[model samples]
Target: MPTPDFIRDLRRHVGTAELWIPAVRAVVVRRRADGRVLPSPEVLLVRRSDDGAWTVTAGILEPGEDPADGAIREVQEETALTACPVRVAGVFAHGPVEYTNGDRCRYLDTVFEMETLDGEPRVNDDESIDVGWFPVTALPESLAEDQRMVIGWALDAGAPAQFTEPGTSHTEAAGEPAAQHD
Candidate 1:
């Protein structure tokens, strides 16, 4: 039989494995320009406190927290933007590799099109460094590739349409099935 230390080491290694099955949360998106809800010219984006990664508001779901509630809370906490849940854009099994923390956790990213209520978003320094509005065509350059894909999917699928696949982020553009990440 292995020693306790051996078991500890084994767990440390396997704990990070996808088999570990970490819980993931949904990501939310909002339309600004020419929106049915808010006739505006700006869209919200968040600048992560770490890595300065600018992207749509998102976060991990807490134990027993409703997925929709988590998305609303995260976006509000990260961007301070009041938004109404519109529809599910898609779901993706992603990010089992890396994160702001060195420790890895898998992500089940649910893309949503939320409607902004009032007050432009300002970054909540605890979770994000900066938050502001931008035109869809002139989004900040710091957006991650994944964000680009999500935004692309939202634009292509015309938010409000339901998507449940990982490629819901790019199915229309792919012509065929969009490449699955997980």
Candidate 2:
């Protein structure tokens, strides 16, 4: 979809300043006919209209919205798919992305491992040009780096949510699970 009304309103005051936005990604995975997710599973991906890059369904979280709900909402909005979030797959800080319009944003992104509840994939909104599923081993070459990492987390069944630590690159931190604190 277009820039959300809340962000547009914020832009009126901030004017291209870097804003820390909360975003969510739904890495919707499809199980085999026998209900098996292992070996090789399919993942839903969209080809973005702006960049034509393949990525999982993702969008900015609405104010006060739960992150998982935001992820489900984005999947429906962008790909016409109803999904249920199974677990948080990862969380990461991504981007000081400078848009063509000069809006800059750094996103604190929550990634969810989701299952498709219903509906076939289709480009349901202006944000994406196409939508389809691909096996994890055969993902599009144009998939974004961060998205690839999040998908990896989702595919690693039973793994804890992945997180990056200070002074570590995302690749270096990929295998590290979020620490549990007492």
Candidate 1 residue-pair clash tally: 0
Candidate 2 per-residue lDDT over residues 127-153, each given as its tens digit: 889999898989998665677888998
> Each model's C-alpha lDDT?
0.55, 0.80
- In model 2, the clashing pairs are none
Alpha carbon lDDT of residue 91, candidate 2?
A: 87
CA deviation > 4 Å runs, candidate 1: 1-41, 99-102, 156-182
Each prediction's TM-score versus the true structure: 0.66, 0.88
lDDT (Cα, tens digit) per residue for candidate 1, span 1-182: 11124334655777644422222222344544454643423456776665666667766555566767776776676677667666666566554454333445445666666766755678654666777766677878766556666665555545554444544323333333322111
RMSD of 2: 5.8
Lowest lDDT 10-mer window, candidate 1?
A: 173-182
